[model samples]
Target: MLFLQNKKFSFSILFLLLLLTFQPLSSSQQLKKNVEFNTSKKDHCQKQISASLLFDITLHGFLLWASMGFLMPVGILVIRMSNREQCGRRLKFYFYIHTILQILSVLLVTAGAVMSIKKFNNAFNNNHQRIGIGLYGMIWLQALIGIVRPKRGSRTRSLWFFIHWMLGTAVSLLGVFNVYSGLFAYHEKTSRRIRIWTIIFTVEISLISFFYLFQDKLEYIQKQGVILGSDLVTSTDQGLSPNDKQKELPTDPC
Candidate 1:
């Protein structure tokens, strides 16, 4: 009977030890699983948040670029071409079109600004944001300047024109640069492919530059032709005899 009791006690001790040894392993496994699940949940949440941010950023970025980068330059080009046309009616038509396009651009930019403010809660924190704010302010100021333009013959007209031209050119160039920066930011934030956008933007800028250069050369040629024609006419008149010159002169209607 003593031997049986001792054997039973030994078996009990072994059983307790086995339980003790396995209990910690089971708990540790459960804890590890819990931690992994929590980590996965966190990763999913982060992905969702980043996706939302990317959507808003891309939408507003496109709008901002369209308004300031694309439409503004096109408006300026239209007005420039109108000036070259030198026809009052055509000029007036294009002037109205330019104004309408610019107003549309301002509206688009305003919408984009609102979207950006809603998303970021602060402006001018980053380089892109700072440039965007400056561009917005300058655009509105340019519009005001257009509205308060001096009369064609006013003494201050030249000064106003100079200021307007310089300001407009600066705004356009800055806007282009800002768009590029915005694209980079978009790429960084979302890790989406930007090669296509970069290519498209490069093509657009190249076309615009080519058109500007061609137009400039064409204008220069036209001016030179006009000057040469006037010189030839003057020389021909000088070569004519006095009687021929008098005969060529317009007679007073009696």
Candidate 2:
């Protein structure tokens, strides 16, 4: 009977050891489950982050496009066409509209620049990023130029006009080109289609270019009209840029 009791005790000890060993197995299984759950959560968060990045990139492109591409060019168009208006409130009104449009453009571009700084890494390694940096400096320079503008008949007015027109033209062209590069970058990053957007933008730029050049050549197209380029240049207090209005004909002196 004593031997039987000893055997029972030994069996009990063995059972206890078995229980301890299986406890670790259960814990290890639970740990594996936890690890899988965490991994899935991490994957979900990464997807959300990627989606957010794409949206922000798209917004950046849009802001730049509106400011530099659309608004700036339209402003130039407004002022250019307004040179045809007789001196008075009509010209002043056009000027006001142009001023308003340009102000809005600057505001939009500033917002875009801020977004790029905050959201993007800004390595500036690519043409798009490099162009963007140039655009920022040029924009501020243009603003300074606008502020320190000379009086209408001042000697520096012509020089100022030249710089303003040339720089404005350059900004518009570069901005448009940068947007195209941006679209390319977006496609490379996201592997998404941008063909529709590219086509639409191309159409928009073509239309604006057509009107800009057509108006410029309208004087020459008017049935073999005689033009006196240099003599008619100083007709207004504000010197017309030879580049902008070289085709203006002389006023009939009766």
Candidate 3:
């Protein structure tokens, strides 16, 4: 009986040791869980990076569009239209519009330049970056030229205007080209579509160009219409003084 009791105690102790050695979760499972968690963290980080890049791109593009595309073009149009008008107050109003719009455009451009320097990569390897540098320099130079204008009759005034006109034209052309290049760059970087945006910009430019060309010929077109000269002559005869009528009568000399 004593031998049988020892055998039972030994069996129970061995069972307890076996239970102590067993693990509900293995080391391999814990490693796999850690890897999965780390993978999810990395994925979340990538998503945040993409979102931030997208925001930066959107803001930069908006600034460029407002500055170079919309505001500057409208400013040019206002200045051009102002030249066709003779009223002083109306001319002043157009001048004010042009000045304010240009100032706003410069501010927006400065903002975009700041953002580009801070947020974007400065590799300068692409056409977009190259053109942007030139375009911005030309814009600033154009502003300076506009500010230091000579009087209308001065000898240098003509030269100044020539330079200003050329620079303005170049900047406008280059700005539009840069915008197109930027769209392509964005697509290259983010693999996104830009067809509709391109189309919209093209249509807007076309309308502005149409108005610009049409305004120059508008006066000529108006002059081509028929006039009522007979009514003007009758009105002039009715408004004549009595002495002027007496001078016109030859029968009184007889």
Top lDDT hit: 2
Which pairs clash (backbone N, Cα, C closer than 3 Å) in model 1? none
List candidate 3 segments past 4 Å from native.
Answer: 1-25, 226-254
- lDDT of the structure predicted as candidate 1: 0.88
Q: Mind giving the per-residue lDDT tens digits that candidate 3 earns over 166-247?
A: 8888888888888889889998988899999999999988988898898898877766542456667778899999899988
- How many residue pairs of model 3 clash at the backbone? 0
What tens-digit string does per-residue lDDT give for candidate 2 at 1-254? 99999999999999999999999999999999999999999999999999999999999999998998899989988999788787899899888998888889989999999999999888888999999999988987887788787978899999999999889888998999999999999999899999999999999999999999998888677634444443464466257676556567565789
Q: After superposition, how far is residue 22 of candidate 3 from its true place, in Å?
A: 6.1
Best prediction by TM-score: 2
Error of 2 at 171 (Å): 0.7
Model 2 Cα displacement at 230 (Å)? 26
TM-score of each predicted structure versus truth: 0.70, 0.84, 0.79
Q: Clashes in model 2: which pairs?
A: none
Ranking by lDDT: 2, 1, 3
Candidate 1: segments with Cα more than 4 A from true spot: 1-45, 121-125, 223-254
